[model samples]
Target: MPNKNTHYKVKNLHGTSKDRYSKKKCECDNWLAHWRNNTKSQRTTCAVLECARKATVGAHVICVDGRMSNEWYIVPFCKYHNHYEKKDEYFLDSRVHLIPVYKLDGCKRG
Candidate 1:
């Protein structure tokens, strides 16, 4: 059995075209800076309904429609949901609920 105290680390997807990391700076450093410098309280639970585990990461939801106006929504998520939530195949045997993000608000568009 997995220890409850074990913290999960998000790994950069291998052999993929996505740039999960930056060559100029550490992604974790940037995330930590954002995580620490913020005055708002961090979310303590996964945003998925009924999930009670602590949110270990901020999962960004990309806008699927062009009409939505290029927006990236970020939500608190646990390791399991954050990992499989984006993979469409996970829905084949599961009823996953996706929360939509509509505006960037204070965040900048890249």
Candidate 2:
């Protein structure tokens, strides 16, 4: 049986609740949209080396420090490499190089 108390515990993990994460995603849409529209090098090259696929999505490289970092390294990645369950393994093995997308001074991922 699922613990009824599990919900409270999860709310505190990584300084974020599941509800907060969802809310943040909605808030960040404008920032993402602006970035996609304004960036000159809308990266089409896949971060994974030797892959000829055109990249279409921004994939965040999870930071090593283990705290859910607001600072993220966004790499241009194809759909397959971005969202697959085995992405971490592929990243570790391939050591995908990421390009840093500079956040504009006034722009915030709120």
Candidate 3:
């Protein structure tokens, strides 16, 4: 049987998150709207890149499949960071690279 107390883990299956930004495309118009209200500006703390989005932690699609990552929330990446990723370069997208990559313990998981 499933852990009844852990039902919180299944909440984000259909893009049902507190913030819609997590499901938005990389270059969407509303991309930075949520963070504008946040005090962090665009600072990120994830291991993916040293950049920052409207969010410190971002909802990332998995490379293994067209699915959102069940374990990691890519964070702190600046707009330049996503460009590096689309180019398939080794500079960005480094897991907990030169900077500290702390995992978000409370982020909704798929």
lDDT of each: 0.38, 0.41, 0.30
RMSD of each: 11.1, 12.2, 13.0
Please rank every candidate by lDDT, starting with the best: 2, 1, 3
Candidate 3: lDDT over CA atoms? 0.30
Model 2 lDDT tens row, 45-94 = 55554556777765555444243353544455566666545324222213
Off by over 4 Å in 2: 1-39, 63-71, 89-103, 106-110
Per-residue C-alpha lDDT of model 3 across residues 12-106, encoded as one tens digit per residue: 12232347534433332232322222223334432233334333333332222222245433323344433423533222332321211132222
**Candidate of highest TM-score:** 2
Per-prediction TM-score = 0.41, 0.43, 0.26
Q: Residue-wise lDDT of candidate 1 within 1-110, one digit each (tens)?
A: 21212222222222221355222122323332233223144446665545677767655544332324333434455677667425521111122222223222222234
In terms of lDDT, the poorest run of 10 residues in model 2 is 4-13
